[model samples]
Target: MKNTIFTITLILVGLIATSCSSDSSDNNLNTAESLQAVTDLALSGTWVISSFIESGTDETDDFTGYVFTFNSDGSLVADNGTMTVSGTWSVTSDDSSDDDDDYDSDDDIDFNIFFAAPPTFEELTEDWDIVSRSASRIELIDISGGNGGTDTLTFEKN
Candidate 1:
């Protein structure tokens, strides 16, 4: 009788463990989906350059009064209240190059901005690291510039 009872207890424990594992997997999936949704929503909006820092110097006024519109289809339009320049933008995962397996690291996302227009706007292009992001703001940093200068760009909803 003791042997049978011991067998039943072991089986029950295994079943409970499996159930808990399944729930944890589901929770992880939900978390991933939520994060992606937040990123998408934050990118699809009209933003203005609230702050622009290059090589530790401020250059926010370079884009003053300009509004950048990021469409869901990866198209971007920058309007300086007179003329508009078209471009493309995309957000991608940078996990492949991550040195560590830390899933919560901010360096896991790459915010790429591309433009082909007046030379002035070219400075705003790069595959930047997503330092931070929210519903009303996004902060990006580029540390791989050929000039060995770091660039930080902050955009706030307009």
Candidate 2:
């Protein structure tokens, strides 16, 4: 009788542990899905640069006149005068949302940047820290270290 009771207790403990593990995995998946949904909604539209502030500088370059087109197929094209640049972009990772209750605002909308420059059209990509995102606007921090200054670009849907 003692042997039978011990076996039953062990089996019950194993089942409970497995159940808890499965619940955690499900929670992770749901969180990921929620973040992806926001990204997909933000990607497919015409976004005009509402503001561009270069990091470390008090001067803010107003780009309210230009439009940035990001197609659903991951292509990018921007025209701000006679100059036009074409490139491609892909989401490297969906970090988390910018909810005041959950994650820090600074860590919100974090993702990567992929681009193909002119002449060769070779693909070049880098990680960009996204500052904030919504159905109508996206703010990204330029993480590329070069002559290009770090900038915060705010875009609005057109």
Candidate 3:
């Protein structure tokens, strides 16, 4: 009788442990999916520079100069001149979603940081705040100077 009781107790403990483990695993998977969804909404493609403007200047140049790719692997290539500069980037958020204005009620959003680039403009090096994001469009603001303007960059999935 003692042996049987010990076996049943052990079995019950094992089952409880297994159940808890599976629940934890499910939570982890959900967290990963949430992160991927946010990244997909933010980064996973090519972004074209629709507009470029300097601070305190009425002059806005519609140059072919632009940034071509920003990858989730922290790699980026920007075409400013004849030269192509490459660097790693990082992303952060004031909260999980940076600013609420950048997303719809159903949208997920995040902020990104750019590092190690050629000194082109103070705006480029500064923290690029994602003002709004959607399936095909992204609005970014240069939070560098209080005078920083917004750029609406559009992309098609390639």
Candidate 4:
């Protein structure tokens, strides 16, 4: 009777442990379709720069009066009534690279921006990690590989 009870207890413990365990793969299984959903959300509306921090300094004023639009074609435009700047943007996921990158995870997603000219707008160009997002707001961050500085950018619906 004692041996049978011990065997049952061991089997129950094994079952409980298996039930409580989590699948790590599920956390790193970011798919392209989900990334497209995020891009679609950005394309849904226009936004304005609510905050910009570069190496602990706030620089949000640099984008004053500018409204940004992320189009479906990957074209990004910033208009400030008086002037307009054309750029490109993309939201991409790179699991393989993130495996070794300290700043990212296996399911890391990056928001990339590129502007050819205008030094002020050029400052926004980088592969920023998506911190959080909603219909009204989106937050991004980047840690410079060269300078070890942290930069943050936030966009809010305009």
Model 2 lDDT per residue over 23-125, tens place: 9897677657745764585576777766655555533243445566766676777666776667766554344433222222433334444556553222124
- What are the lDDT figures for the candidates, one per model? 0.77, 0.58, 0.54, 0.84
Q: Estimate each model's TM-score.
A: 0.71, 0.56, 0.50, 0.78
Q: lDDT order of candidates, best first? A: 4, 1, 2, 3
Off by over 4 Å in 1: 1-35, 98-107
The prediction achieving the highest lDDT against the true structure is 4
Whichever of 3 and 4 has more lDDT, that candidate is 4
Point to the candidate with the largest TM-score.
4
State the lDDT of candidate 4 residue by residue for 64-156, as single tens digits.
999999998999999999999999999888665542245453146778899987999999999887777888988888888788899999999
RMSD to true structure for each model, in Å? 4.8, 6.9, 8.7, 4.1
Instruction: Give the Cα error of residue 156 in candidate 2, in Å.
Output: 1.8
Q: Tens-digit lDDT track for model 3 on 57-96?
A: 4322432555557777877676666867676555543334
Q: What does the lDDT read for residue 89 in candidate 4? A: 96
Q: List model 1 lDDT by residue over 38-114, tens digit each.
A: 46765667899999998889989878989999887888899997989898987766556642222223545667788
